[model samples]
Target chain A: MFTLYEFASSGNCYKLRLAMAQLDIPFQRIEKDITRGETRSAEFLAINPNGRIPVLVTPDNRVLPESSAALWYLARDSKLMPEDPFQQAQVLQWMFFEQYNHEPNIATSRYWIHVLGEQEKYAEALAEKQQKGHDALAVMETHLSDRDFFVGRDYSIADIALYAYTHVAGQGGFSLDAYPAIRGWLERVERQPGYVAMEA
Target chain B: MFTLYEFASSGNCYKLRLAMAQLDIPFQRIEKDITRGETRSAEFLAINPNGRIPVLVTPDNRVLPESSAALWYLARDSKLMPEDPFQQAQVLQWMFFEQYNHEPNIATSRYWIHVLGEQEKYAEALAEKQQKGHDALAVMETHLSDRDFFVGRDYSIADIALYAYTHVAGQGGFSLDAYPAIRGWLERVERQPGYVAMEA
Candidate 1:
């Protein structure tokens, strides 16, 4: 009974869709085209003042924005979220890292290059983003080298949060060839039950 | 029983120190000077490959990084975090907004201008950051206009997360004259029990 306002191509939006699919939660999807100014409209602003997509309206009509918050809401008390307090904090640590470290560089670069098709105009910004994006991936690679998942040996929402942008990093001009551990981990996440791919 | 690796002036690191004080938790503080490259040392990198401070080593010697994650851990069972699932998500929503929308612009600009003293070299980036920082403040003003706090009726870590960078936004060249609601909210948070100010 949840209604999700999203932009399909956005990895932030995709994180919620993928999480719902894995949790077997039935929800309605309403596409908001940012390029066409759908998200900035007065009507959409009423739903989320932030004017961003991937907002989840609950069955009771409460509006929840922010994809990572939505993922934590949907997965809490489920196996996707750990029971241990420390483990839960660890999962949150990675989710915060995805938002703070990974998304700004990887997702923003992908939007500029792939969706907006303005790579030349954003050349300078993209260069800085590419370097930082690789640094984020390197951190993930090192973490994954000794662990199969970002948290406590399980496929949690932390995996979903990081996976959304990372799987499509090439769209942002990032190469995965050097990250063997990340590659293996990506495949492991894909093998999880009810896993859904990001739509084109 | 806890060891905190932090940078004294960083709002991100200060969030942890402030939270621990409000919660009445005792911990040892170890300051790592990022300007002096303390965070990038091989020894520091071993604890957090991300090479960032505000890392909390738990009583069991488990290392945890990321300021928001540390806030969640320290406040999980306390009144600082809500028990209701929906309220908890709302708290997290604001926390994410602080990290994604607020911090990057406000905190980064402050670092460049105040700490690094390189406003001239980062002029172009600072201009963009200033605009976005104002936008983020606008969003908070709208939200706070109708509520006493970010989530529910009580103060939570969401306020702490946002308050960290915002209280000193003037250092980043952002004026608070237009944000009356945010100004009032800041005072309310300062009046909270056990509240601690960021160290000089």
Candidate 2:
């Protein structure tokens, strides 16, 4: 069994829970409210000095943080991880793209506009984020136009990683109407077995 | 042999070169000058739609982008990667931290202040980047205070990934004087066999 410390609404945390569900791994969830300053508390800091949520405490009592890392751990030997060395690297490439290119823009915009409701205060940043978020979506749209999945023609954690914030991107003020391929790909992800939607 | 498309001065590109040296892997290098807009060319975009340097083309003609993912690929079967699953996840955790936390602040600051010399132009963002970069260093200091490396009691790709930008963080106006543990850890990394320095 694993113990996951997370924020229920966070896409980063949702990535882990959704991966575990797909992999059929049993884990306990401990919710931390970031908006209430819970993640910054001393107790949570002890679990992850970085003070981020979606940390996994393994059956052996080892603490693992970083949502994508947890996904890789849970799906390592499963069909979710590609076996070919190059394909494995490709999976990681998209995962990194999600963090570096996609999440910072899409997720941050969603946080400011939807969760925090501080869109006015964050107007300047949000404007820049929206442009970059669309750039990220365009890249995904181009890639998905020729493929069924991100790697190896199968639904892998790369899909899950990118899907987390992307599905809720509308709340961030991004329109999916311009991205036909990404829209089709999102539906393909939803149809995966044992899939769990991000909780409200 | 592998073919690497990179910018010689970028810490992100240096990461792959350094890792290959440490692992004794030989690869051909193709330099792309980002300042000259070489990465944005149609040819480069055909190789990686992301239009980023540090892309690796495998012998089998597979194109892989993203520095840390390429590091994982080259080091997966080597001593640079942990054999244990939990330790592997730990390695991935720090790699993710390097990408999501450390690199964005440290590397971007370096580019603005050192490479582009745009400190005044990016004054507002630079100020925030400096604070976040220091916070990232503090986390590394606290962690290194108790350990020699990021994971499994050995130097792994996690160290390589973080070390790429961190050793040069001073160029970004980040002082290393307060981070004695991180300074010592940097020296420890330099002492590893087959080590290579980031090019000027």
Candidate 3:
């Protein structure tokens, strides 16, 4: 069995859980709370020098960190990944967009507000992320305006990457009311086969 | 021929130029000045809703943005990309790391100080990024201490992704004197075949 180091409440970690469940890949998860500094423990740091969670240890004991990388690893030769080379790159396009543009703003805001209860402390940073977060959502809204998914009009890891944080953006004080296309896509993602709701 | 929209000096844009040069993929270039707000122009926004450079239009007219994604597209079936499944995921691991940890801290610092000439204006933010950039460099140092390349000990897109910002980190006030391993890796990258220097 594969071993997963994760914080249950984290969307990044949840991306792996959701994918493994969807792919029917079995793995045992060990919860490491980031807020409590569990991830900073020397043992945890040994697995990932980066000191982040959602690390996957392959059955052969090969360790991999970074949620998208782990997800890409799990999606290989599976339906979650595309066969077309261009579509595969398109999957990467949105995954990078999520990490660079979306997650930093959207996910961090949620971590500050909902997870850490530090909305007041991070108010200034939160304010700055607000506009950028919406810019990312607007990009998604426009893209999804015509297509059902981010690439090849199919639900792939790109969708999973974005959906991890987007579904709970309201927790970060982001109102998705104006993004009809994004809302529509979120609903479509929830209905995919073997889709498991993120555990609270 | 492909059409590359870029800001010539940007490491992100340079990634494509370098990759295409090494891979022997020819493309026409159009320079867009981010400092002058060229990327925010409507024409540019229509091409890339994210308002970023390093957008590539394939010969068939398919538009792909995000530097790593474009690199993956160009590296298809090439030596720059590994064929092994796990190694491919490892490549994605470092590329994502470049986008998240390295670029935001290191490259953004270079942009503000070196390109935009606003060191005084961004002093506080620059200070904050300094620690993070070094932290990223530290992680790289540890990883490269034993390995010549990032994945499979080969010059893949993973190295290209990090080298773009890292090689010129000095311009952003990052000192490589303490990082012997990283220095060695950078020199190794410079020695790769078909390498073309980024035009200033």
Candidate 4:
């Protein structure tokens, strides 16, 4: 059994949950409120010194931290991970983009404008955030326009990674009106077998 | 043939270079000056719409972005990527930790303090960076204390991902004296076949 320590609102945490559901891998969930700093507790720190959510405790007592890492673990050797070298690399390429470009812009903007409630204070930053966020989305919109999935023409961890935040990007104040391709792709991912909503 | 668009000082780019050298895979190198914003140019962005350096272009003109992703591509079906399901996840787990905890801290700190010398401007954020950077180093120090490599007791992409930035962490105004374990691991990575210096 895998025990997951997560925050329900976190896209990173959601990545793990969605992947586990896709694989039909049974796991336990322990929620942590990052805003209140529950992750800093001594007990939690012992498990993950980084004190972040979505830490997966394996059956063998090995604790794995990081959401994408957990997803990679759950989908390992499964259909979620591509068999070909180039296709596998394609999955990772998008994952990296999620972290470096997409997440930083879209996820950060969403956190600031919606969750933080300091939109005015962050207005200037938000403008840049939206632009960069859209830039990332635009790239995705173009790529997804012609493909059913991010790589290998099959659903993979890359979709799981990008889907987590993208589905709720509007909550972060990012309008998806222009990204019809990405929107369609999201529907495709949502329809995957064993799919689980973030709130679910 | 693989053509890598990279910057000499970037740890992310260095990871790909190091891996290629280790595998004795020859590839053409196209150095980009990130500081000059070469990555944002139309030509470069065409290769990688994300406008990021370390984009790997295959013979077929397919462009793959992200350093870790590029490493995955080069290592796919090779010995560098772990074969076992659990072990591969372990590798990814560490890689994700590097991005969220380690890279954001150590790598960002190095860039701000050493490369840009904007410590005063980032002073308010400096304390947080310092704390997080030190904390990330602590995790690496402890992990390396017990293992020769990040996963499976052999050099893999995990080591390659981490070694890229850590070896030059000192260049970012971080001291190596506090991390003897990491220093020792650095030596081990250096001694690996086809070890390439950061500036090389």
Query: Which clashing pairs does model 4 show?
Result: none
- A81, model 4: CA deviation in Å? 2.9
Model 4 chain A lowest lDDT segment of ten? A109-118
- Please rank every candidate by DockQ, starting with the best: 1, 3, 2, 4
Query: Which sections of candidate 1 miss by over 4 Å?
Result: none
Which tens-of-lDDT digit does each residue in B1-200 have in candidate 1? 99999999999999998899989889999989999999999999999999998899998899999999999999998989988999999999999999999999999999999999999999999999988999999999999998999999999999999999999999999999999999999999999998999875
Which 10 consecutive positions of candidate 3 chain A have the poorest summed lDDT? A146-155
- Model 3's interface RMSD: 0.6
lDDT of 4: 0.83
| TM-scores of all predicted structures | 0.99, 0.99, 0.99, 0.90
Q: What is the lDDT of residue A114 in candidate 1?
A: 94
Better of 2 and 4 by lDDT: 2
Q: For residues B1-200, what per-residue lDDT tens digits would candidate 2 score against the true structure? A: 99999998899999899889988888999999998999999999999998898998888778899998999999998999989988998999999999999999999988988888888998889898987888889889999998999997899999999999999999888999999999999999999999999886
Question: How much native contact recovery, as a fraction, does model 3 achieve?
Answer: 0.93
Give the CAPRI class of candidate 2. Answer: high
Candidate with top DockQ is 1
- Against the native complex, each candidate's DockQ, computed on alpha carbons, is 0.93, 0.89, 0.92, 0.71
Model 4 per-residue lDDT tens digits across residues A36-114: 8899999889888777787998878788887777777777679899988788878877887788777877888777766
lDDT of each: 0.94, 0.92, 0.93, 0.83
